[model samples]
Target: MRQNPERRTALLDAAIEVLAREGSRGLTLRAVDKEADVPIGTSSNYFASRDTLLTQAGARVYERLLPDEATVAQQMSSAVGTEGFVYLMREAMTRISGFRTGYLALLELRLEATRRPELREVLTKRVRADMDENVERHLASGLPGDAVSVRLLQLTLSWLILEQLTLPDIMTDEERDELVTEAVLRLSAPSKRE
Candidate 1:
């Protein structure tokens, strides 16, 4: 198997584009080759099968979707309290939505996972780990949120993102912004005194 890191990344990125544009049914080695502008058999050298390509493409989406160290440092330095928590969530939403193709590919991977036990196992573990990491980060950041709060906000914002991506006309920008703010405020609030 080819071990050239840069070439592998390029192939995986092309796979992501194909998955996003054509969904799982249309994803093929030839499609990825054309998308990557590589030779017909180039993708096969890096990926042993369509399942491997699909799995790697799913991993690549997370690689692209997660914020880099620099972005995380910047966000952490400026974020404080509930307001900062809201800001963080808004920024996260923006970052995730910005990678439209990556997120769309992720959606396809999720749907595809239903039938592929291997994909389901990998995706379930990855998503669970991501959620756990988010919970730990929220607790450490002094963001006025507990683990449940973080989990709740994650679930709600994900749906909002789906709406934004698939049906932009359903909600105006202001409405979405307000929803983000409200979700953070309500989810992260401390329990009332007995």
Candidate 2:
């Protein structure tokens, strides 16, 4: 079928909302159409089946979850150094905090992926590719971190982000920043392997 990018995006966004609010079990084409406020068949027209919708919706959620240009630039810029790294982490936190619903949907996607190996493969591929790109960016910037180190840093920050946002009173903004800063410092420190 011919495609309308705008309509597809709208349906995917609605799917994300449904996933975040009602979770994977509630992700149906009709529900997506209803969420999008389009006619009842709109989601089906865009997606072939519920599995397709779920997989594409997972991809869409991850796509939107990526950091923007400014954030990427800060992370890639050389003048920032370790301090710049901390700033990048803070910028990420700020953006993620603002996109709480999107993040929730992403978490929902992960939960759904766990039950479906095909979906899990798709997500893990995308996520690992993203992480590899992040490590390359850091290396290109002359930052000190290999893929493994960058992976550790990213995972640490991701868990911290999830907790600080999902669990109230876990840590204040400054406290989280300090924690990430420390992690970055340790990661950037010259290692025997380096």
In order of appearance, the predictions have TM-scores of 0.96, 0.90
Cα RMSD to the true fold for all candidates: 1.2, 2.0
Q: What is the lDDT of residue 172 in candidate 1?
A: 91
Backbone clashes in model 1, listed as residue pairs: none
6-93: candidate 1 lDDT, tens digit per residue: 9999999999999988999999999999999999999999999999998888888989999888988789878998889989999999
Instruction: Pick out the ten consecutive residues of candidate 2 with the lowest summed lDDT.
Output: 71-80
Model 1 residue 59 CA deviation in Å: 0.7
Q: How far is 117's C-alpha from truth in model 2 (Å)?
A: 2.6
Model 2, span 137-189: residue lDDT tens: 87777765566778888898889878976795988777887888899888777
Name the lDDT value of residue 119 in candidate 1.
85
